[model samples]
Target: MSFRFLPDDPVASIKLRPGQTVMVDPSARRGGSCLEVLEGVARVYCPCEETEGMTLAFLQEGDQVRTDRLCSEGICVEALTPLSFRSDAEPQEGVGFDSVNEWTLQLLRIRHLGNAELRLHALLALLVNRLGRRCGQWCDLPFRITHDRIGELIGSTRVTSTRLISKLRNSDQLDTPSGDNNLRLSAALIESAPVLG
Candidate 1:
């Protein structure tokens, strides 16, 4: 397998202080170039068909975010903390970038899942698989994500997300260990999420 990472010679490099936002237009991706995070956290807002407006994803270091039609009407990348990133405005073939492609495809699949609540569960499961830290059959998602953030990501209202989160928590599929804001996900429960009816 062959792949190309984002260009080292980025068209632009920017530093954002916490709470700042950058709006990226489709024109910025004219050459197939995209944005890659170098440090800190970015909260991405991309419009989705299932959304009345946009959906959100909290990306951390090494996350690649598309600046193309995948975010029709463009997208916003907000700095949750101090952030540094680069954009490769000039397109390059992603020859061996299977991970990036797979990441995008997985999100797309989650966005199009037939069941809304199932989609949310699946998204959490996917996140666990991609980003969780293993601990004796449990996976810790080392990110501070609130029910409101979950709502934004899954295209539901805050109240709804909060309720759903409580339900999932009660069901033993997800947990928050004492003194830790990070979510702990059950590996067995994540595997069983898809078949949940």
Candidate 2:
């Protein structure tokens, strides 16, 4: 399903099932309006015809997307997990931070790493650092992203991503349980990543 921010409503809360998308039309949104993630995770992407579906960032609870900064074609937010967000947040003055921009910069840095393996390691470390939590022996991410998405983030082919992931599994650095949608990475692996250091 899809939703558009309506100017008539000063505030609105929307919930979406996994894989569903919502379009935030800048023209329809009130000035200074923002979208704040309330629960779960979302993948924010470009919705313009020329760059449609280009992944911009991932947002989790408390993250906000400032509509005023959106391009003319606006953006699309896809539910990566059960997602809920508010559409009419009061704009903050001088907050001086954009999560989307920060994520983009980090992903760019990962892409510039010398090798695919280092890039992948850095990407995983970045995700886990920003979105996962340590649980005893492992750092657990709440949701699993497909190898294709991982490949895109790390500037590699899906086959390469799969191969790298397989190697991590073999080395006991990563775990994906058959019935679970979460991913677990060894603490040692995360700690060893030079990107975040």
Candidate 3:
């Protein structure tokens, strides 16, 4: 057993016996996860499924998964790969983590800039940046969780969320998928849409 922990450059290399399951605790609160396939495949379970059915997110060697920040686990996950996790998480922030670093503070400054276009564009960029993904120029985004849900996350609303996102789509800033099932968003659409208000 020759193992070591590396924080500066995180890595995981392990050979778990077949059928071995470690760290299977729900109270094991999670922040976020990104995975890379090394030797096998894995399934990420939807954490929020009521006892109905467990939803799975399949990942291959070249795929990455980002779970939401608040967790009681609507996304339940299981290893299809002989799992190796390279995790980066700080201890729980009792009052949130603004003081983590200068960049965090720099982010806050954008909120206070007082210029509408700059402020809105910056915030829009941040919104898409933080909650967006780009795979070959298209972004697979989170969609249709209700405008109120959007408001709950950013102090806006179901109507406001629908309106702003709608405006983005109309102005060509963002695109929302047609049905509730295909909420995956697109970044290229955002790019295709000029950045003018």
Candidate 4:
């Protein structure tokens, strides 16, 4: 029987059995691709010569990003780990891409611009709410990212992303715990920033 994959179900094609791992290839575009669960579980990795081996996004069973492309700039995606899954079953529902594609488009707009303006943060905050995985109050994801990748994806460099994150934090626009690799943002934090408009 075909498995009916739900919206936001445990991302399959991963969480495999013991000693199994799949080598997910680089996505044609960022954020979304048809991953092959050849071994165990997989994480999205972005290839950055500088960061060594860091990721920029993460997906569990049933997770898909940018299935729809809303921007002119193509999405950048790579696998973080070798993963595996049961590929025998067929999905009842077609892989949905609406929400993620919308988020990608909005983020593309933010990156294309030079600064992380207020309205931009507003949208990003929403996108984060919808796209990010929640660990208690903190929303997190593995964005195997680098300075250059951030700049390219958001139309800026690692330095720019870092500065913006710092600025947002200093202004109480975000909350990323000290020494944590990911940035966690709340609605209030993002909204507090001065509107770029």
Mind giving the per-residue lDDT tens digits that candidate 2 earns over 135-185?
A: 998999888988988887888899999999999999999999889878999
List candidate 4 segments past 4 Å from native.
Answer: 1-60, 64-89, 92-106, 112-127, 133-147, 179-182, 191-197
Winner by lDDT: 2
lDDT score, candidate 4, position 128: 54
Q: Whole-model lDDT for model 1 versus the true structure? A: 0.66
Q: lDDT for every model?
A: 0.66, 0.84, 0.40, 0.42
Cα-lDDT of candidate 2? 0.84
Candidate 4 — number of clashing residue pairs?
A: 35
Worst 10 residues of 4 by lDDT: 1-10
Q: Write the per-residue lDDT of candidate 4 for residues 81-121, one digit (tens) a residue.
A: 33344332333246554434444455545554545454345
How many clashes in each candidate?
3, 0, 18, 35
The per-residue C-alpha lDDT of model 3 at residue 59 equals 38
Any runs in candidate 2 off by more than 4 Å, and if so which?
1-11, 49-52
Model 3 earns a TM-score of 0.33
* Candidate 3 residue runs with Cα over 4 Å from true position: 1-110, 113-124, 142-145, 152-159, 178-197
TM-score (C-alpha) between model 1 and the true structure? 0.65
